[model samples]
Target: MRRLRNDLPYTFRPARPKDWFRPPALWLNRHWLLERKYRVTAIEEQGFERVRELDATGDSMLLAPNHADHADPHLMMEIGRRYELPFHFMAAREVFEVSKRASWALQSMGVFSVDRDGPDVSAIKMALSILAAGKPLVLYPEGEIYHHHERLDPLHEGVASIGMKACGRVSEGRQVWLVPVGMRFLHDPSVEATFRDRLTRLEDRIGWTPKPKMDLDERILRLGQGVLGLKESEFQVNVAAGGIQDRLESLCGQLLEMVEARMGSDGAAGTAPERVRAMRYRIRRRLLDVDHPPGEDERTLLLDDLDRVFAALQAHSYIGDYLLAEPTLDRRAETIMKLEEDLLGFPLYPSARTARILAGEPISISEMLQRGELPRKGGASALTSLLEERLSRLIEVPAGAACSTELVSRQSGETG
Candidate 1:
């Protein structure tokens, strides 16, 4: 739920990947930063034997993990430290813009910047080189952190494309493997009180009297609706008449359509995130064109369009019945964390948590191509689906008791 500013021009930041720096940096992060700041007290890694096995065979590896939290990259560093592997990461360019020191530290840690709003050729080339050199590369196919630990957003096919293309570059007799790494965070049960306090604060911020007597699920839903309504008003959107999910989808769609219209482009056909990316790419290309810079008024409009693009993405993240379907403590906490970020402009670290890092079976790109499973026409999509399915299985939630129908109905009442 990080709010990225799109007004800045992108400069591709390649990976320096200092072998000497990574070990100590990771140790410091694991011992200090993660435990003290991120509240990730423990990290348990599973199935990394597969990673070790692949490393043993001199095979190239592309580790695709489901991105659920901002703490994921640090957790990956912990894994690399535990297994003694050099891991290269493809991170968003916005992260590098935080500060010069942070950017330098990230690059030294083997992290490169990628402009998610556009095609970053530098990042693709770096990834290709990492894989071709028989090294392990980590890329999150989910791309953005939605803070939904139990479920995954759609997997971007670009990861599969990079893996397949890297396969073509590898020396004969060697293979490139795609490993789906699942990350799940388990918060301490005592943190429920902290979550409740967060909900109360959100209610107070929205000018509503705290509802201590209300069930936790209902309070969360009401808070979400309140936040959504505020966003709709801010964007001058009509409060769509429907349940939370429906209203969210409607608002997101309208926002994207607005951006597309302003950019003088036809609507892009894809997920909300995809369309937003396409529009942002077009707008940024124009904005960054120094030789033919946009006029002051036009620049103002373009910046406004960028704001709408981000708003659309934020709305899209909340467009689901994540809590209503099964209100696990993790789900409830994640929902509130997202709300905190959106409302207060920053999220508070709730409590100490354990991150379970499970590496699922690796899918061999070479074997799939040889087996004709990856046809030329839709090979990327096919591979993406397979990767998505694997990651989903690794983090699959057990069927459990859900909220009663009456409660769900009450929670879904019209928010407009």
Candidate 2:
């Protein structure tokens, strides 16, 4: 049998209430498990000192960060160590359910579960408890890793809702702060070659042969169009062409329409990410629990439906790369990484890449309440958009940075 590398080990602890924030074990995990083992090159701090100031004031806080990659949680831990702040993190229950030992370790480290697919009241209460205690809680609003560092996925409204609700729970004198954090992954320039090689390998594996002298943009367009084209064919979609973004959007809309039609559901409104979330919520209602466990044939049919749902979600999550109009070398490299991850199911980038942890100015719950933003109808949606806007600005790669657009241009088809 082939051997697979295992994750870091942890000792088990009985589930109970404890001082989860101030654990000496977390620092050890950050040093040995995250930085040393995972090779996190450096965390470029931006506006982190502001968080330090907030900590000194003893304000209750929740961090809503953009989820770009798998390493974000660990990177945030390292950030916490540097700032001398301990935080409680909200994690998906399935992570704790991976193994008993893993569950115990994470739970010991001030991590609590929030069921993403369903209403978990206990999890909600736990989050409120932490906030009411005046401790900082890190809640990722994006909900899952979308693998685009510069893009902010549509946020889940739960973050804003919880923050406002927790604010109300706090004493009149105390404040609950919602801090927006942007985790941007930056890699070495040499990785451009790596990206190209990887893309070439993927193209070969998928049996795609680009026309001679194709520019980088054209090649990328062709590759993306090809993938989308296949999915369209599978769904019996009439081919629509108007560059990558237009066609991809149309295809996803059609797919979602088909999904909603099958489920006897309507209201496929909002952006792709929003539609996907709504669709998944409906899907969960059907699949979450069955009184009787399904037979083999029943399980296969159920699995097929799930596969389609997830595929649609992924298509929605990933199409944001089209937003990059000025594709620099860094942007192009990251795009290739996206392709590698999406196509070959590979890591987005090497582990040794530097992560820029950008913390925007914390939004004051008191101020928001006074401004009539909190507790208002559609307030959560508005606040989420505001947070997302802050994150988008924070992750913006400087246009003046030394990146070779020529490299990308050279790789494109002649028409590009």
Q: By TM-score, who's the top model here?
A: 1
Pairs that collide, model 1: none
lDDT of each: 0.83, 0.67
TM-score of each: 0.92, 0.81
Q: Output the lDDT of residue 81, model 1.
A: 67
Consecutive 10-residue window with the lowest summed lDDT within model 2: 1-10
Clashes of each: 0, 7
- For model 2, the superposed segments whose C-alpha errors exceed 4 Å read 1-39, 208-217, 266-269, 292-299, 320-324, 371-377, 397-416
Model 1 spans > 4 angstroms off: 265-268, 397-416
Taking every candidate in turn, the Cα RMSD to the unseen true structure, in Å, is: 8.4, 8.6
lDDT of candidate model 1 versus the reference = 0.83
Question: What tens-digit string does per-residue lDDT give for candidate 2 at 160-244?
Answer: 8888888778877888888998777666666655555566776886788744456776677677767777777776766677766
Measured with C-alpha atoms, the lDDT of residue 143 in candidate 2 is 84
